[model samples]
Target: MQQRKQQLLRRHRQRKRVALLLGLPLLFSSALWFWWLPLPLLLAAWVLHEAYFADHLFYAPGDDYDYRFAGAGVSVSITADGRLGLAQLEGIAEADTLLLEVTIKADWRGCWVDPRVLIDVAQPHDQQTFERGCAGRRVVNLSGLGPALAAGQVRLRGRYCRLAGQATLHVLRNPDYACQRMLILAPHADDAELAAFAQYQRGAEVTIATLTVGELEAEPYQQLGLSAIEAARLKARLRSWDSRHAASWGGVPAERCFQLGYFCMQLPAMRAEPLLGHPSKVAQTGDIRPLRKGNALPLPGDVDGQPSWFNLLGDLRGLIEHYQPQVIVTPHPQLDPHADHQATTAALYEALAVSHHQPQTLLYYANHLHDNDRWPMGEQGEGVALPPALEPLTVAGVWSPSLSGAAQIDKSMALGLMHDLQTPLPGKKKLRRVLQHYLAGRRWPRWGVDEFYRKAIRRHELFFVQPWPIKDQAQRPE
Candidate 1:
């Protein structure tokens, strides 16, 4: 009787253990399924928003494309003999025929196919041609030919307005890319290379200029949540790392990298002149130099017997004048979410406004896509589009150009060299939280952040060009 009772008790305990094991899995699985439910809902919302509301920001079927272009203007050069600036027009003139054609480029607005070029063949010798609808062509016809424009010792003079808007962004119509010189501006170190890797492949003489020491992001307090000394050291290390990486990645000598030494995160509020005859949180000029690793000593308006060359605007203009780049690439001035990025754009624009040099194209790229905690968007490869509010100033639709497979790989490698989470900092936290920022959902703990950044690697890149006659001060400041 005792043995039979014991057997019964043992069997009952076994049954209870089996039940508990089965019940735990059901509870765990239910919790996981509940967490995944909202993720799909969020994705659906994003898709709906993009298709219905976002796609039509700048373009619709019947918006009357009148704002497509601006700044149709001309530049004139005259020569003696059967010679004109353009090869086609040079042959147009007979040995005794004086020939001059106006060369004009479509500005930030779309190109004017053939505006009008009026050649003043009127002089001591009134031999010339009166031409209309000729501003857009490199080789222009000498219409209504006369002696001064037609014959001996003709003095030709031309006046042209430098157009502001005419070049519009086109999905199909790519601008004559800048081959000789390219100037890329970044608010911080890693920004330029990420956006402009494709630009480098075009074989342009690329110059990347970074705006600050990049210390703010490594801040001992909020940025990386580091101590001051550690933050400064990290900033210096990052600057050095970026410079080295850019040189190697672009296949250019390292010296081409320019790091303008300014305090990070202060640009948007920075001023050239201090208030009330006092320097109030004034930026240290440091002789208007680039990326000095440490705090700059207080500097006077003038340095070491040199005239006051101590202004942000002046420094940027100096770079512009020096490079005379055919293309000036920077962040979207008004559209960018980051204050430093906006400030960088404004500074570049101000410098361009003052400098005599002109670039054929002013292109803008974007980042700061989501709140720091969210990323991947779960989609990519579609070209970048201007936000609807920015459509009027954008003038042309942004283009998404595809990169070669090798180029994409190179971009990935370059970005990888930028920052990492493997190394630990204070509080036993990783020095960089790029993973936490890039990947979406709870899966981040399971997958590495580098993998998400790599997944974001798209074959196509996108950008908006600022059209001249910008809509308002909100779009572009005077």
Candidate 2:
């Protein structure tokens, strides 16, 4: 307890130091009555500092899936020509691909310019720009620099920034997604697109199986002057349409998209009570059925689906057996904090266990990483490194498939088509609704608040790849 208190005291002191340094300027610049500007300014600066700088504790300090800085650095130096050269690269020839991680020191100057690290890869004539914000870190794949790295000729170029301490190099195996039969298991609409649209859209045989219609949401819809149930029903229908059409837009035909009409936010309850049926929290119904695009596999037992674990698992197993997919994409149960996301993968594990089915690769993604949506920290359209995360021990590999500028725009457009992704339309009661939303402490997407698109339309998509049937006991439930 004493040690804990000491740690807290240290953190508090650090925060106070930062607050005073930032807050004093505003206080000095303001009038007598406005002298209190420092308090709110201090709060805003502190939040941004924690989100972009501090490494010991991220946004979720006490949560199970909170991330920590797990980078290992090697000393490097820049030449007079401003080319960063690391001598250590010559000795490390084990992996063909590596992740170059660079950290920016936190301070006023570093935060102001938002430095961009420009790396020029020889042989391939490739260039990558890593965007940095206030003491933030970024990673870039070294696959394109394979020839130069093997010959100990790796060099990096940075613009308007100084190194924090040292840069890290993480060796990783790249997973091939070309022409593979891929199955995406999405807990809700837009998840498949958010996670892997750029990856599977071009060269892969993609089949999207959405677990729920997301009928539990009634917020922005209720602002449309509909009752709660009416809003829920409308949202379900529109999102179902969005899922199918969005997939279709990505070269996946409408015939390939499927929605297993389960209600949102109910999967965990279904898992806990396998035999019992649970109704939707908003729609207030227990009917669960498959909305098929084309005939595939029938749900076992009753024709009318029951919102039970048995039926959910049966449907999942049936889909797997029919598809025989080489790659299965779902959320990482350990990293993603959403209950539905964790439950979706949990059901997948159980289904694979019973059917004895094994895929070549199980790609895991985290849409909700307990980090308060502040991850992948950069401008839209920039390359995304692995977020500063406590690495999961059982991951077989880490893959980041790059997207062309056109593909990123296409993804942004596809996300725009989703009804839920549509920002709330201006209405007569706009001000009142905005005030109500704020008072209720609910996050409603206003115009230009496209958090999903900002995070999704990156230069590359990241996934933790695992081989199945997973042999790692730590990855599976006891």
Kindly give the stretch of ten consecutive residues in candidate 2 with the minimal lDDT sum. Answer: 60-69
The 10-residue segment of model 1 with minimum total lDDT is 125-134
Alpha-carbon deviation at 68 in model 1, angstroms: 9.3
Candidate 1 lDDT over 27-125, as tens digits, reads: 567558796655565565444433322211222221221223233223333454222233222322332111122334333221211122233444331
Model 2: pairs clashing at backbone N, Cα or C within 3 Å = none
Tens-digit lDDT string for candidate 2 (231-283): 88888888777777788778887667777778887888898999888878998
Candidate 2 stretches greater than 4 Å from native: 1-97, 111-116, 120-138, 142-161, 164-168, 290-296, 390-394, 425-449
TM-score for each model = 0.51, 0.74
| Model 1: residues with Cα > 4 Å off, grouped in runs | 1-171, 176-180, 219-227, 244-247, 272-310, 369-376, 379-393, 420-456, 467-474
lDDT of each: 0.46, 0.66
